[model samples]
Target: MNTDRLIAVLAADAAPVGPHVVEWRIASALSIAACGAVALLLLSYGVRADLAALVATPIFWAKLAFALTMAGAALVATARLSRPGVAVGRVWAALVVPAAIALPVALVVLWLAPRDARAALLLGNTWRTCSLNIALLSVPGLIAILAVVRSLAPTRLHLAGAMAGLFAGAIGTAAYCLRCPETSVPFWATWYLLGIAIPTLVGALVAKKALRW
Candidate 1:
């Protein structure tokens, strides 16, 4: 076909697209995964017995805030990455903000604590299982997030995967909080962060093949 003819045919095939619904789709997937995760939590690790009494404490909310904040940031980044060539301006900063805020606070808390107690602050009794549990809990959410991302056109496959993992990990941590007895910010900053990193690394490694179109 002639160049002009090919151009005309291509133009004729173009159609107007509707508003994007990436958030809704991702939310639906995450919601489904969250339900499964909740079930897992109920069966394997029920909520802390003192949840009712701890509800009024600032530390409890702090734990929730850390997870939710990172989840929000990761969600924004994942949405921006769903499109091709879109600049996710400062969206990644959201991920860093939580750590930035938490680090300083953790530092201060440690500074104010007695030298003998610093070790306990850093490694709570559940240190051996904390990160592992977070990573394990993230499995369902990771599957959901990856499935949602797979349906989209992501040029940066690895990054999209990592962001999805971040979202999943945070959600998992939040769920784990229901049973997590540790209330130390330092512990959350260290171990919880490691748990989230596990999925992020896995996503980055597998996304190349999984997201290949």
Candidate 2:
């Protein structure tokens, strides 16, 4: 086949290229930060307790850090996929590696702890509360992220999986709030993290494959 025809065929098989990577990254970062800000605001103005202590705690900060890091990593993968000549399979693999390592480690750590300690770890503090708060704060932020991703990425595969994962996380968080009593940081730091972060990471990985053109 001629060069033009060959190139066209290859392009046809590739994922739809959407927005500039940098812009998407910035938008995602801003959305996450906004969520955190809203969470803090709710804690201060709406909730009964002292926001200062909750925000200051190492556990709360750690959860924030983890969420931000995962979001950042997903954005990076998305950006990398925007470049020409990157394989979809390779991008998916890149996204999965860290997650595979982290998931097992998190599970093992939780499993190894004594039963009472584990329960205490998962149910003791403001995890459920913060998760509910975070989930509530996340709704608008997540919607914004979806809109940005749709506008920029526009690929059906990426959009569908990402939105599904996001919706699932939001719903799960809501469910946890209804059923669970404890709302501590450790509770969210464990089960809640797996619930939201895992799906999000999976969505990002899928997006890398499906959105690439």
Candidate 3:
């Protein structure tokens, strides 16, 4: 290679990546994973048998993965929005992609699961229980996260929001487990899926609006 070209290539390769982006990504991933794991653990181990199945099944795992991924994307978008030159529309568009992918996947997975499995999945009673639980768990955390973001301008608001939702879902699941009589895997699976989905949807909506600069 020519000397000038070699120097230019080295400079490009040695360029410093932004620390904020790295911190944002790591924080987002860890926050979501930790919150989701803690919630699921509590529901599965601390709560009754009815709650034990909350984390069971491919569908639940898939949704968790999807929700966390979206949450990460939302955080990235939020960080971008905080920058002076970035466009809000672009950030919003990027944040929406995960939901677009997850909604269809959720539909198909739920539709394809065996009838008994579908039954186990909570649509009516479990759905209602989980929704209430999610709301209770999420509300306070959401307030705290929004406050922190407002004051400190952390780039991980989306991650914080996701953790809040996951914690809420877990606590909510624990509450529902105490009240629920159903112990079957299918019931827990169904209801748990709903629980995760509801918060994920709500988080996405919040991110769309709140993450805007």
Candidate 4:
């Protein structure tokens, strides 16, 4: 009841948290939410009917590579930002490398395509809904990741939130690939990028208030 007694009780209840705990928490939260996002996508959009045929295509793998690589990089950034006083450092390179490789390849592919096909490559059939679908699928992840970060010790609220958003958005885009029938490199590079960007921007905007300790 008294100050001295309360101090003793607090000391007795405290336990030392190891570094592995942090990794496990973030990894588990993201993984679980990713599964949910995929399920949500499946329920709403259904898997592409020709997924088996698409699997053998290079473009399918390329699409996965883009989203997965982005997610991996964002995971690193999110991990670093979850802790106080941690610098992002070369995680920026990890994040940029995917775009650096994918964008150039996309541009080259666009250049060589027939003029008429160029429009399809950029817009695809679902251009109106592609980014929106990805963003919607990411809701589960965004909520879960933010909850985990809030429970941890993040000092850079805005940056931390933005990184979390990017991570979730990447994962969402990856899930959306299962439903997306688009075969254009340019479309992935542009529309998928926008999907992830939407969440990242939203995260940064909300982090200051939502992540405030």
Candidate 4: give the clashing pairs.
Answer: none
Model 3 gets an lDDT of 0.49
Candidate 4 global Cα RMSD: 2.4
lDDT by residue for model 3 (145-176), tens: 34334433435455544543443344344344
lDDT of 2 by residue, 1-213 (tens): 999999999898798656565565545645564654455445543543454656665645544454555445545544433344434345455445444654565567678888777777665655546544544444454444444444444445554446434433443343333233344444554656556654455555566554444
Ranking by lDDT: 4, 1, 2, 3
Clashes of 2: 12
Model 2: CA > 4 A from native: 1-57, 78-114, 125-133, 159-186, 194-213
What is the Å distance of residue 142 in model 3 from its true position? 1.7
Off by over 4 Å in 4: 1-12
In terms of lDDT, the poorest run of 10 residues in model 1 is 16-25
Which pairs of residues collide in model 1?
none
Error of 4 at 206 (Å): 0.9
CA lDDT, every model vs. true structure: 0.87, 0.50, 0.49, 0.91
State which candidate, 1 or 2, has the greater lDDT: 1
Q: Compute the lDDT for candidate 2.
A: 0.50
Off by over 4 Å in 3: 1-56, 83-85, 88-91, 105-124, 152-213
TM-score of each: 0.91, 0.50, 0.45, 0.93
- What lDDT does model 4 reach? 0.91
Error of model 3, residue 124, in angstroms: 4.4
Candidate closer to the true structure by TM-score (higher is better), 3 or 4: 4
Top-lDDT candidate index: 4
lDDT of 1 by residue, 1-213 (tens): 999999999899798765667768888867965776677788888889998988789998998899989988888888788789888789777789989998898899899999999999999899999999888888888888888888878999999999888888988888888889999999998899999999899888889887777
